[model samples]
Target: MARFKTKHTEWLLSNMAITVSSLLSSNPKPLTSRPVGRPPIEYVNAGPRQKRKLASDLAVHQGHNTSLLVHAAAVSAEKSNEEDTALVLKNIYLTPSDHNKVRKNLFTQKTDSVRLTEDEAFFEFVLKIAYRLKLKKWQVRDENGKKEMAKQKNTIQKKMWNAMALHVDKPKQNGNGNTNDGNTARRAFAKPKLLAEILGLDENLIAYFNSILIAISCHLPIDPTQFKKYCQKTVTLYMSLYPWFPMSATVHKVLMHGYQIIEASILPLGVLGENASEARNKYYKSDRRLHARKSTRQKNMEDVFHRAMDSSDPLVSSIYLAKRLGQQNKLPLPADVIELLESPNFLYPCNMDNNNNAPVFDANNSDSDSDSENPFTIEIDVEDDF
Candidate 1:
């Protein structure tokens, strides 16, 4: 027992410093109460009145049940203003709510009242189709098969780029030195007519894209009867083939809402394309970078404005317009393309007094003939390579 007590005492001595430190750290000193005193005369007299005033102010501010509806209304108005500003961003004119509403109307098929602008529809259709084709996944298990499929896909992509006169290189770095991974450039390189034969996509799918291209190309008024027929056939084919695939908003717009949108436009749909606007944007970037003054923002803007004015001046533009027109060596339109067009003559202007007349539509063109007998219809085999 004496030995046990000695051991216990040694343990206690060892832990005493830790226990004392923990107790000191954890236990804070108790606060002392202040002695109560009688209030001054001013506070004593005003206390009840002050308390009533504060309660009334709070009630008005909080919109509590009160007779002062004007104050309540003001509070509510201020709250609404705050909410309106919640989604307001600098430089962007549209609030989040407004943007959402526009997107909903644009993409959603539920609303028959809203219609996409010609440019919007054109780009949406072109970009969506190209993006879908490029990103399409093939089911394959063997390493060799996967490599072959990748090689085939790359070859097709290269062909598309060549057809569109585009050079595929590394993505360009922007002002912040970051490469933009967007497929905007890729969309421009889409030649669906070429893809139709080479990829062996459904004939209806080929005809559908062809019809859209014809409509876009047509400077004359579109025939509603022919347009409707094309729309119906294409939509039916798309629905049948892609029933299992997830449909995007743009696809829904193109397939379901296109006819109404096209019909609603007062001008020819081709005239409404944003190609010029897009070109102008490219010019602006080039002008700002190469020609504009870099010393000050105001000077830079002034120089850019002057440059744009000079470049776009009618006299300046006309001087080189003939030369620019002469440089173009466009290929003949396919027979199918001519058949789909509302006015083929618009594309082949006979009255033009120049040696560089646009190529006439040749029904027996070798390129068109070769398309019918394309050996690249191995796309079907590639799809089933698994």
Candidate 2:
């Protein structure tokens, strides 16, 4: 499993490197590999000395972006492991690479208003802004700019001067026309953190800062489209890092607490597959009428059942409670348990008779034919997804 996850990350990194390398090149290569080294940039396109700066700019930007994302994933994994979170390791693998290819196709797509179906545009814009700021800190910001920064104070002039720290981002939405994020620039600043433990700050804090920065930026301003992208990045990062699957209950809580300030509604990014409907219905061992009627996953029956028992979902909570209590060493679940498993919907009951007692699932078996270990996950044809 660890090996699989490592290779998965490697592929993502490699593909990104390829894309960036292409963009930086005077003549981008066809999607093919040559024996490695640095791909030669022997021929220079005619331009000012500024042309020489491309390699330096690309390196610094990639380093900063890659470092933050890598650390975020690491911190997430460490925290979840310490606390026994649910959605661990499973999200580390890619759905397949074509999802990224589809991304370029969607760039520049716009509408009179935001499209509910495809909404990553806003956060992408924010990222473009942040990247430009980092680049500015490298490419520009001379001694004079430093002096100007040193002079900043709370007066209105200071505000204007501070706001002069413009970086690459989408242009302001003027009455004339729209501007693309990559082609425009926006005011930005680099606030130095005094804390010794940067990542040590709460993960939610990291996400909030990301959102607040976007909210204040004139380019992104407080638009719903941009806000949704911010939420998606946070949620995706959490899913990729945490050990537990964010069930509807937990998902509701996390999004609720995180977005409370904004008072926004978000579409769910549920695990996909044909059995998603079934998983939603009968997977967990929780009550219904008392709280709200809810569903469950079909796979990872034990895990879902456990989640239900822990939450208020009442449906099969008691049954699960009984099984776990009696679990240490048991065989044929008493007749009642057998009847429950035999119920038309419930498939894999705890293998009561298997005194042989096998471990339920292993991470390495992600593609194993037997079955998926994640109860909440859908069995989509990964190829189709890609």
Candidate 3:
């Protein structure tokens, strides 16, 4: 029908516009991996090539395999001065294929069964929690599953979807530039506290999900010390409750080694995370397709270098040249950069003042001795209200 055709055309245009906007944006590194929590239904049901591309992006991001622009420049410089006249090296010293090999190795090398790609681990975790909670009406399913193919929808899953509103649609401000919604309504309901409150989860379930959320979030602005303690307690409880579950392995791993992994890295997690790599991969793929030939690699490399040089600020160019020429000591970090790094507000929040003191339990039910011993016991009325 004409009406159906018009609707389809509108959908196509909207999608094309979105794609173009995404393409124009720089692929900055993420605070966490792409497909951070779980694989979307569409991604799960995608064909082989689509799935492979998703996996490839995850691998690239997980490994934090950035193109070392400085190193690439060094390679190009050295190759140009080679004695062999016939052997002209147009590309940077490191090939794009070399980066791909490293990314491939990241997926293949890890032996941990819990490492079922970025989204898979997240999906498994969500499924396990949902199963335990008796939220099976709209279950997370595999691509090939009958349930996944079925069109019938469930209400419980709809409620859960509302609870997981991570990216909220903020109300548009008027010409006066004042927020229409108050702070209470504007507050993110996706947080564990709100999710527990809105979804009417029990105290035990609240504590369990709270811990899982803390462990999973790589860059929450909470105090690291309190976060570590909270993570330790929650992970211990979750593992005790669901020791046999595969996602428990992920929680267990986080308990043992997750905190130290970030500390060991040279750059911030956001800088090295997969977002940047995947973005470059997308650009390269599109450009390579257009310029398909034996010499394409060399041509592309030259293009990348030219773009990098052209876009770079004068100060950045000087610093790059200085570092490349082994005069890095001559250029000290800018005062603003140093000040920003040293500022307490940069990435982490200040430590909790009363972290050692446990929160008060129900004032009505507890004896003095009981209250003193287990201060973390939450009030029963909180559950009653929920």
lDDT agreement with native, every candidate: 0.56, 0.38, 0.44
Best by lDDT: 1
Model 2 residue 70 lDDT?
44
On residues 66-137, what C-alpha lDDT tens digit does candidate 3 reach at each position? 444334435655676743421222232335555566567667544433234332343335434544343233
Better of 1 and 3 by TM-score: 1
- Which regions of candidate 3 are displaced past 4 Å? 1-123, 134-155, 161-189, 197-227, 239-247, 279-297, 309-386
Model 2, span 79-114: residue lDDT tens: 757433223222233333554654665685554763
Best candidate according to TM-score: 1
Ten contiguous residues minimizing lDDT sum, candidate 1: 175-184
**True-vs-predicted CA distance for residue 214, candidate 1, Å:** 5.2
Please give each candidate's TM-score.
0.41, 0.16, 0.33
Pairs of residues clashing in candidate 1 = none
lDDT of 1 by residue, 65-158 (tens): 5434434444565576854433332112433356676677668656244454433344344433433453353335677666665666566457
Better of 1 and 3 by lDDT: 1
**Sorted on TM-score, highest at the top, how do the candidates line up?**
1, 3, 2
Comparison by lDDT, 1 against 2, better one = 1
On TM-score, who's better, 1 or 2?
1
lDDT value, residue 13 of candidate 1: 65
